[model samples]
Target: MYTEENTARLLPDVAVHAQPHLVGELDWVGMDGIEVPVRFDAGDGDVQRASARVGAFVNLRRPDKRGIHMSRLYLQVEQALSTQTLSTATLRDLLRGFLDSHKDLSDRACLSIRFEHLVRRPALRSANSGWRSYPVTIEASMIGEELLLEFGTEIVYSSTCPASAALSRQLIQDQFAKDFDAGKAVEHAAVLAWLGSEKGIVATPHAQRSVARLRVRPAEGAAFNLIDLIDVTEQALGTPVQTAVKREDEQAFALANGGNLMFCEDAARRIQKALDADKALSDFHIRVEHQESLHPHDAVAYASKGVEGGYAGKGCA
Candidate 1:
């Protein structure tokens, strides 16, 4: 089927290939948040004390005609390691540079960093306390001239379910009363024996592990303190976890748990209202996951941080 002209064209070698007339649309997908460990705050303290790690997400843009440069993202982050100064402001600057590096395709960018911000505290009784870290994090995004910033912390609180414990007490009381009302009043020895048996044991209520996740978008020139959210969340949970716990502190923790028995659902609702009432956050995604011991499955519930979606008070919460 070959002609003289076609054979001549097919055999010739060329230095250039034809350029594309059009390009395809690309989805610049990414892993939004990843926990990374690196040395942070290394200039002022001992190596052990100075050791710090923070989670971060890099901004990326996919090419319409070809592919995205993934290795470049990793290179930028690895460079931050030796520099050692990473703050909210520094992160903002870094992201802008990232976006500008790939301006031909994508128009939006996002980044999130999670890390433990530590503080040293003295022991309650002994002078033997060390350092404890709090979960501190930041999230940011840029689309054209518009910018979004968010920050938060996650804290643990123990709350005991009072209703469940009260029922246990009532059941024990009824059993004692019925025994006393019988033809023969129960003897002290017999009562003592009953108390030693499983039949007379009172079931203590279970405590719940609660988490508070908050996101905020502050006005221009406004200061959004992440610690403020930490304080509010710990308070909302009733009892915050202690960094240094002696016998007395342990007892106090137990007492707090005995008083606040909340299911995973209770924790979510309480936190949702707290954020809703606050003027700081208006649109957020709030999720609480409860790891259960009684069952193999975990209980979870979610609420949007600052939206007007009707809360139906359904399912677990």
Candidate 2:
């Protein structure tokens, strides 16, 4: 068996860090798509353990260093995640560990984690419920001793076009006028039957599937409130997609969509207003996309909290 001392003597050890000829500081260097097991808090005092895809990086401040200890960064992430719950404090510790491991070479560290968060959603008008998965991403960066945390998620809903709805009402009114006679008594049952017939309902509004993607940074010392943000968004939109559905639930969903006719601009503003009301969030960026049924392309709008030097209203592609 070869010992550590014998191996070092037999092998050529290249001092890459000592090479001054190839000296240049790198903005970022490390690993991406690293698989790790992490524990997440569901904001209800429940802890969920799941596998997540992670990315870890650090900025090389030393010009003479050839490269960073990539394996050390990976190990640090694994160790930190295995020992702590997922939160702002956990992320700050993990990022600090990255810099600690590369003390002489790096001064700034960053980490990103992506996972699918599953939550149970009840039916609109039924006793049953089902699980819905939301794509979530958590990112953190540490520069010196300051750490910034960001959270992102996506919500899918229905958007009924306001223009199409008005047009449809006009057509229905025209159909009803043609079916009825001027100054004539109409039977209640006959009118009800006519309203249910195809001729009476000549047109229907066009509604399309829409998505709201948001990224937010919570205020300092505030806990990460993922479920609270989700609730606020769904309530503000008023037509979130349902998981479990019976006939009654389907009917309730239809009524909800009919009542909440909106354009892409409307959805974006609703989310912006809801986020503004939450004191826990300090900065945010939101984008709502209406996959138009009338047009081949999608209509999109963006909004932000407009904090100085914070996130701009950018598209989430």
Candidate with the greatest lDDT versus the true structure: 2
RMSD of each: 9.1, 2.0
lDDT by residue (tens digit), candidate 2, 78-147: 9988778898878888888898888988899999999888888899989999988988899999999999
* TM-score, one value per model: 0.66, 0.94
Residue 139 error, candidate 1, Å: 2.6
**Which structure among the candidates has the greatest TM-score?**
2
lDDT of 1 at 80: 59
Cα lDDT of model 1 by residue, 96-212, tens digit: 655665575456666666667675645444445766676655667777756677766566666555566788888888877765676776688988998887768556565555555
Provide the clashing-pair count of each candidate structure.
6, 0
Q: What is the lDDT of residue 282 in candidate 1?
A: 41
> Lowest summed lDDT over 10 consecutive residues: which window, candidate 1?
42-51
